[model samples]
Target chain A: MQDPFVRIEGVSKLFGAFQAVRDVNLTVGKGEIFALLGGSGCGKTTLLRMLAGFEEPSAGRIFLDGQDMTGVPPWERPVHMMFQSYALFPHMSVEKNVAYGLKHERMTKAEREERVRAMLDLVQLTQFAHRKPHQISGGQRQRVALARALARQPKLLLLDEPLAALDKKLREQTQFELMSIQERTGVTFIVVTHDQEEAMTLADRIAVMDKGQVRQSGTPTDIYEYPNSRFVAGFIGSITSFDGRVTAVEGEVSRVDVPGLGTEIVARSVAGAASGQAVTVALRPEKVTLTRDRLEGPNAIAGEIKDIAYFGKDSLYRVTLPSGQLIAVHGVNAKRAEAGRPDWHDKVWLSFDPAAAILLTE
Target chain B: MRRRPIFLISVLCFGFAFFYIPILSMIVYSFNGSRLATVWGGFSTKWYVSLFSNRQVGAALLLSLKIALISATMATILGTMAGIALARFRRFKGRLFFSGMVTAPLIMPDVITGISSLMLFILMAEWIGWPATRGFTTITLAHITFSMVYVTTIVQSRLISAERDIEEAAMDLGSKPWQVLWDITLPVIFPAILSGWLLAFTISLDEVVITSFTTGPGNTTLPLLIWSKVKLGVTPDINALATIIVLVVGIGVVIAGWLMNRAEKQRDRDARLAYRANE
Candidate 1:
């Protein structure tokens, strides 16, 4: 079997007494766009820096393409990083900036020029080649930084918050551009971002981090659908959780008694779950359906609409159960008319499939 | 409605008149037909010709220029290194003391600086038997000592304001530390270094107090020459020399100011353009 393009083995970092990253082990396949998703100070950036060789791991080792990366300086590492601020060389023109890294490649002059031309064309900034960084737009400067980083055709590229500086409209547009560029370059990418939507939209796989440790690592859909812990569920998206105790265990399902809803919810059986074990049933808001008609079976709960928030395509309803617990339910406005839509203080029924509810042990 | 502050305008006018009248009169007097400075006999170029013929003042002017150029260049190199150290290295042994000492010369009185420099030179000459006599070498050293402080302040502030990530990005792009310094850091701070050099040159050119204590025979700068002549009472020749000095220094200052202003405007324009383009 071929080895992973990049492998991080039990990496850890400490700043003085503060542990910034703890025992992180990850692997990235070739030409894959992987995201390190977390909030500020969650060791996402620390790991990226370690990959770029800016920070050495306090423990463990890193290997790139079957070679040990220990004791390698950043300049000697076969990696490049697009800094968060797009740190373009302000003194150099866009063309010169793109060519700056190529100076060390030992290429012929004409070959170097051709590489720079190709890079600028790749980022679609050929028109701004002669202009200095400050003379260009922020988005244009970001492209210049990308061009410069990719000029050398690094084995791995690390991007630190590439779209965080862009405005909303520009961010959406740039997201597609970034994906297309990655597709064309075929370079393995490790992007660190705090925006969950960005990670969901951009990455093939994501590692959700908290504090100084990895909470979960999987494909975006896998992480959203089946989070192993409460933190992962909360960090990925909005979820309404209920306190429950396992009442009975059947062949492939477990019956959970939730006092909050005064109902027994049938869910997929969790590993190591006992008959009386306490657990949380986390259900995404969008997974539950809201209607005025009564729902039968263990998958349904009756509630009254306490509040409604209209959000164009979808509306979020806060439903208060008979037990006085408030639960959120999301309904898509698929129909044009509001004739049968539930409003505030109206009776409603929330129903979900047994597979839609996630059982979290933590 | 807002008031224009008429009283403030009058105060500003008074300050300008007080400062400019003497220099203006001297300039006007340099073209005097007669030797007397108080009464300007119709404009003539006689004193200007005599001033050029005076070998003493000519030699002094050349010496001052040479000293200023050499010292300012050396000071800029040394001071820029010091600035980089202070700005980039957050912690080193005696960092606080080093920064304090670098800036102390800027605030220290010229008299004290001159005396201290003179004493050090004398002690070095006696102990090491180097720099046998205090002449051009001593004066140039003294000028560099003080001029470097100004350069350090300017370069340090520039480095502080510059983003560190630019250099880091260069390193990540496969350039070594020395390559980043040469290709990235130096170019970014070149404008500040230039202005610092000009300032140091101006300060060294007209310096009197420090030069007075440090100089020995045959090291008379332009200001020192002008001072002795002034004590003997002002002459049309001296007036011509002062006017010439003022004109040269004025031109230098105007050019330096223009360069600084242009650099500032270019930076501002780039920032504004980048911001507008971002949309």
Candidate 2:
């Protein structure tokens, strides 16, 4: 069997007394746009630096395309990094900046110029080729950085916070541009960003890291729907968690008595589930349905609408349960002009399916 | 309103007069037809013509210029390396001491620096018999020692403000460490180095105290010559030489300031442009 395009074998890094990255193992397929998502100082940037050969791992090894890249320097490695600051050569023109990496290659002057021209065209900055970095707009500079990093056609491209510098509207636009460019080039990309939405939109798979450890690695939907730990659940999306103990274990499901909602909840059984084990029942806000009448069958809780936050397309309702636990319920704003919507202090029923409750053991 | 306007104008005039009166008097007397420097005489170009004819002054001027040019260039090279070492290597064992020693010359008295450097050169000569005698070499060495501190300060500040990630990015894009330094680091800090060179040149050209201690019989720089001539009382020809020196140094300083200001303004304009682009 062919090995993965990039294989990180238990890589770890130590800076003086602080361990920045710890025992990280990952395999990325060819042409995959993988994202390392985390908050500040979670080892995402450290891992990206290691991949670019800027930092050497204290333990284990990294293999790229079946080659051991243990002692390779950054210049010799067939990897390029797009820095968060863009780091475009301020003294050089955009065309020159794009052509800089190509200088090391044994190409003729005409071939180098032709390659730069084609790269600028690819990033849609052909007109700004002669302009210096400071003369162009920020978005244009970002494109110049992208064009430069892509000019050499590296086997692996690392993007550090690729869209973090742009405004929201611009970020959204560039996210699509980045994905399309990656698709066209077929180069394996590993993006490191603290922005979860950016990672979800851009990456085919994401590794959520915290405290120098990978908490979870999966598709965006898999991470959101089936988080293995409480940290992953809270990091990926908005979740309301309740402390409970398993009261009964059935064939494929379990019943948990949650004192917070003063109800016995039925949820899909997690592995190693047994009677009288402490667990957490995490539910996404959008999974719950709110109605004025009491919900029939199981998994219904009696509560009152404590507060309401109205977004343009949706309203988030904070419901206070009988046991004083406030759980959030997100409902679509299907009705126009303040009709058939629960107001503050109105009694409501929050209901969800048994399968919607994620049973997290960790 | 009348009192405020009158007060502001008086203050402005006083500041200008206090700064320019001495230089103005010197310039005016440089064209005096009389031999006495302080007396008002008819304007003539005779002192200027005599200044060109004075071979001693010509020799001293050339010597000072050569020393300044050579020392400033050498100081720039050494100082930039020291600056990069201090700024980039954060946790080296003796970094604090190294930085302190580099900056010590900035605050040290010129008399002490001159005495210490002179003693060291004398001791080295006695021990190794290398320099043989104190002359242009000792004076140039002395100038380089003190002037390097200024260059180091300028280049160090520039290196501190410059993003090191730029160098890292260059390396990541298929350039070695040396290549990154040449292609990214040096070009970014070139402006500061240039201004530092000009400052060192001016300082070396006009230095009198340290040069006095380091020079031997034949190594009389322009400043040393001026000092000796002034001891015998100032002359109109001396005034002519001073005026010429002032013009040259002033032009050099103005060009340096203009270059620094232009670089600063260009940076500001680019920053403002980037900020507006975000909006």
How do the candidates score on chain B by TM-score?
0.91, 0.92
Q: For this target, which candidate reaches the highest DockQ against the unseen true structure?
A: 1
The CAPRI classification for model 2 reads as medium
The parts of candidate 2 lying over 4 Å away from their true place are A335-339, B1-13, B124-128, B255-279
TM-score, predicted candidate 2 vs. hidden true structure: 0.94
Kindly give the stretch of ten consecutive residues in candidate 2 chain B with the minimal lDDT sum.
B270-279
lDDT of 2 by residue, A112-183 (tens): 999999999999999878878888887888899999999999999999999988888988999999999999
Docking class of 1: medium
User: Isolated chain A: TM-score per model?
Assistant: 0.98, 0.98
Per-residue lDDT of B1-279 in model 2, one digit per residue for the tens?
699999999999999999989998999999998887667779999999998998999999999999999999999999999988898885889889999999999999999999999999999999999678999999999999999999999999999999988899899899988898898899999989988998899899999999999999988999999999999999988888988878986997799689879988988897787667657
TM-score of each: 0.94, 0.94
What are the DockQ scores of the candidates, in order? 0.68, 0.65
